[model samples]
Target: MDDCIIIGAGPAGLTAAIYLTRFHLSIRLFDCGSSRAALIPCTHNHAGYPAGVAGTELLRLMLEQAEKYGATREQAEVTAIVPVAGGFDVQIGDRTAKARTVLLATGVVNNRPDMDPAEHDAALQRGLLRYCPICDGYEVTDKRVGVIGTGDHGMREAIFLRGFTPDITLIAPGAAHELDDACRAKLDEAGIVHVDGPCTPIRIAGDRIAVETPAGPLTFDSIYPALGSVIRSKLAVAAGANASQDGCLEVDEHQRTSIPGLFAAGDVVKGLDQISHAMGEAGVAATTIRNLLAEQRPIRR
Candidate 1:
């Protein structure tokens, strides 16, 4: 049986593999090869990369580093996991492997906005359109920005966007009643314009995003879709582990899930979805797993 199995190849999974391998434990990383981080053009907040680095480059370096330490990465979709005698059995296609410990770093998938001609336009992809305020909010400093969403999380994004740009508009596709009074007050205090109702349509022309609203066609330098992400924590949840309301796995500070021998880190756990945070959690989880395994050794009676 392998010492541990990491269920992703993102920043967290790769980092965990690096640490576990250093502890002289065998690790297998399974991933479907799609990473939300890879979709980002460039990330500025990752530590050590002062000038910033492309998401793809960071992932490549991480995987390469893990491989250097004898970590094995498999490109496969994990269908299910069943608890076994000493560990768990992971099913991939028609094959299965036993693992003494499991680290779920499956991460999350952000729901994309409805496809439109504006989104399909080539220029927007070049650099005009962006997401992840932590990644590109600085680029929109002092510029007109539009935020699309209406819940607490959406308001939080609006407040964050306000810090970067004075001209902030909150687009609520539903009735204004959906938002609480406290949230409304916060938006008012920030002097953010609120549009309560359906958005007509949006198109990207040159460097501007044109949106038709009840008032009229308004344009902004950028639009931030504050719609939250859908966490993929079913594998852990099905194993009798707890999760947050948003589906992020509930793990201890050591990144150990409710189920013993099962751990989680990165975006899969309830916390900031940042590369630095993921790496830190991975380190803790690797150490915890190593200690757990060491304790499991039979005593010399």
Candidate 2:
């Protein structure tokens, strides 16, 4: 049994483990070693490193920092989480570890196009298609861009894209009338073009993305997929934690979920899903867990 068990080795989980280990808490981290952060080749927006750094390198440094604090890292997939008498049991492979607390930082997987590498390689390599506006929106200033996705998230991304580019199009795979009057009005006021119906196949050539739509084959400098993430919240949800419509866990300022002894951060929780935000949430969660554990200690007579 350990004081804490953190699932996922991404920024949020690693940061939480580092903080908890520094507090002299025994912590174990379970990870599948798949972080969306690896998709980024170079990141210039993250604070610190004036010259910027490679995403893989930054992740490596974070892992090193966590290990230096005595946090045990194991490569394993967490199949399930079961509540026990005093805490929780984490099922990994055939083994189960009981912990007083658990932090779920397992991030979401971005839904990407299933295009062949040779076809979409250039576009993917050049950042023509992006998933995170908070990370790459600034780079699209004054450029014609198209966002693919439907529903509230798509509408929200379209609004956010307006900050960087006026020539923006929100391509929904469904009927335009599916949006409420307020959202439609906002798009109209923003001068954003809305195209309904299925997205035409996207063809990447040189530096432009040629998307075939019912309107016509539209060419844009960039395409953003605002499709919601498939957040892994079943473990926490099964433990009686609340979640949003998109399946992201609901947490408080302390990053504690509705379930006692269970906490979550990063994309798994409702937020901007940025590295900085994730790290901040992890710090808060670590402090909260530490306090909870301290309070549980028996007082000597």
Candidate 3:
């Protein structure tokens, strides 16, 4: 059996693979090609990249680094992970790979707006549609921004973005706004415009994104969809691991999950959903895994 099997080849999984492989531990890295990080056009927040780095470029570099140290990678999705005798039986269709430990870096999927996929992609590439203001709020600084969401999640995102730009609009994804008294008070105090929605993306013109709202067609330099995400924790939860109500995996400081031989990192574990944070967690998890396995069996050159 391999020393470890890592699922999801994002920054977290790849980082772990690099560490474990450098420690001379055998590992198998699985990727389903749906890493949220891959969608990032360019991120300026990730340290050491002054001109900012494209997500794809970063992942490519990490994968290369991991491979340089003999980290085996498979471009296949792990459907199920069953805890077996000494480790886990990672299922990928008809084949199964066994390892002494399994690390999950399977990240979350963003819930996008109801726009046409082509249009959405175009707008996203053009920097007119965005998510995660924390990642790229600087790109939209002091520009008119529209936020398509409501309730606490919407309110919080709008308030956070307010620090970047003064012109902000919070529009409900449904027919009307769902703000309670406190939510309204907060928005009012923050000077955010609240509008009823069921909004649809009308068009994307030069440097502006247009959305059709009940109030009328609205245009903004950028639009942020505050809809939540679908956490990809089903594999771990199905394998009898404990998770929070929102489906985020519960991990201790060392990134150990409730299951002894199973571990997790990245967005699945819930914290700051940033690439740097995920990488840090992966580093800790990889070291812990090395120590734990050494306790069971000695490592030698």
Which candidate achieves the best TM-score against the true structure? 3
lDDT of 3: 0.94
Off by over 4 Å in 3: none
Tens-digit lDDT track for model 3 on 58-164? 99999999999998788998899999889999999999999999999999999999999998989888789898899999989999999999999999999999999
Which residue pairs clash within candidate 1? none
Q: Which candidate comes out best when scored by lDDT?
A: 3
lDDT of 1: 0.84
Per-candidate Cα lDDT values, in order, are 0.84, 0.85, 0.94
Candidate 1 on 210-258: residue-level lDDT in tens? 7776777778888877767889899989888999887999999899898
Query: How much is 141 displaced in model 2, in angstroms?
Result: 0.8
Tell me how many residue pairs clash in candidate 1.
Answer: 0
Local lDDT at 2 for model 3: 92
**TM-score ranking, best first:** 3, 1, 2
lDDT of 2 by residue, 1-301 (tens): 8889999988899899889989888899999988777677567789997777766788899989988989778999998888888899999989899999999999888876544557664676677877777887888899999988766777889999999999999887554536788888888999998898567588786778878777778889999877667898888987788999889999988998888899998988888888888899999999999999889973232
- After superposition, the stretches of candidate 1 with alpha carbons farther than 4 Å from their true spots are 117-127, 174-177, 298-301
Ten-residue region with minimum lDDT total, candidate 1:
120-129
Candidate closer to the true structure by TM-score (higher is better), 2 or 3? 3
